[model samples]
Target: MEPEWIQAMQEELQQFKLNNVWELVKRPDPRKHNIIGTKWIYCNKQDEHGQVVRNKARLVAQGYTQVERIDFDETFAPVARIEAIRILPDIMHSVCMCARFQAAPKESHHLVVKRILRYLAYTPTLGLWYPKGSEFDLVGFSNANYAGDKVDRKSRSGTCHFLGRSLVCWSSKKQNCVSLSTAESE
Candidate 1:
């Protein structure tokens, strides 16, 4: 890489506050634990208007290298469904409801935040793009294919609300009731 390009990339990484995308990790003690292998990834950052703004670097661990207890005790994480996200705003519509709600539990919140940080580390340059000259109209679409979930044999549907060609909101979920026929499901 050119010296100027490297310097520019370093500056951009610093601006994003992502200074630790790569670092050498001393090999873990053989008796003490398992250590995950890591890999480096690179990409270009794009602005909301779809212009390439900067080159990005990321370091990601090979999660499969982890061993139980030695590397990690638990690897499970919870993620909210789109319906849950959609309902949250509706549920909190009342001012009193917002006031009565308690903050998220700290430990869980910390774990969630840590996972997000790790994700950012692995995909530093990933972002949305809304280029100029696009249409600006409101449009929506909803669709589903029955028995989408192999575990439950349930039908699932999703809806996408768009502002012109830019997608603003979308959701996917299992239907509340089972339908005997495809027409009924539709």
Candidate 2:
């Protein structure tokens, strides 16, 4: 492995230690018990200009090899994306696009997600605040994309609700039925 990759691996191990990622246990008999395996996923961190910033190494489980009920009862990967809570229109668009392709995400999608996370980490004040004296004025706005998804030709619906000038709620979901025209989509 390259030096950068080694450094990244070390950092990841450090994080695992700091976060209490695992418990030390006696080695299980290979013939009696199925021991889970893990793999290292490596990626190149990049900047907006497409320049390589650093290396990122993620230690992930080879969960596909494990039996569903015997090896694990239930499986869930919990991730917290802070940008989803904020009402930044640009960020939401990027986040929504990333989520749409999360199953088989490309390198570009990964870069976009990294950018969104970095933005949220540095500049953290783009948040909605409900003040006590703020007048109650509920306003809602909605829009739809006609045949937004090129694959299925499914239209997308988005809505934003605001109390006075602060945005409170927002949602974007793909329409169930494909609409031939924009008028039908609305």
Candidate 3:
């Protein structure tokens, strides 16, 4: 029987191939083009009491070696952030993406990831709860941070919609235009 980690890796690769995640092409000349390396990350999912619940493996592109224009174009991806006093999967995805983009995600990124993992372990069964026959009122909340991103000097805005105390939709994104004032950003 195959080891659990190996089986998990095989499953991940199989899904990628089935989904047409990438195509196989002749290796580009080393002199002209830079071919990014790939790595397999193995992790064990743990429950609230620290018991191993599942074995997981992920194949990730080595983004550090990638050049901005030559290897990839844009880094912006739509991410959703919901503020319902609970941690959701979208926040984890966002954090992972952010760590991937960092040129050197050394200690700080590792610490952040570990913190998130610990939080997940502490709340394994937590999830959004929407009671039936609850109030049907739709409420929306939005806020913007002026020049939140120091590197780009762009404002960031986030909005969340609630349907009777249950979060339905949410989005957090950097503003397209630079805001001149806090009022404009808001």
Candidate whose TM-score is highest:
2
The worst-scoring run of ten residues by lDDT in candidate 1 lies at 79-88
**Model 1 lDDT per residue over 58-130, tens place:** 4445776544432224433332111121222221122223332347446655555555556557655764466
- For model 2, the stretches where C-alpha displacement exceeds 4 angstroms are 65-186
Q: Candidate 3, after superposition: displacement of residue 32 in Å?
A: 1.4
Over 1-186, each residue of candidate 3 has an lDDT whose tens digit, in order, gives 349988888888887787677899999998999888999877788889999988888777786554343223434332111111233354434454555548877777777777667656776676556578779898989999888788889888888777787676677898787645554553
Number of the top lDDT candidate: 2
Over 4 Å off, model 1 = 1-133, 176-186
Higher TM-score: candidate 1 or 3?
A: 3
Cα distance off (Å), candidate 2, residue 79: 8.6
Clashing residue pairs, candidate 2? Answer: none
lDDT per residue (tens digit) for residues 142-161 in model 2: 99888878999988888887
The best-first sequence of candidates by TM-score reads 2, 3, 1
Which of candidates 2 and 3 is the stronger one according to lDDT? 2
Indicate whether candidate 1 or candidate 2 has the larger TM-score.
Answer: 2
Q: What TM-score does candidate 3 reach?
A: 0.35
- For all predicted structures, in order, the TM-scores are 0.27, 0.36, 0.35
How high a TM-score does candidate 1 get? Answer: 0.27
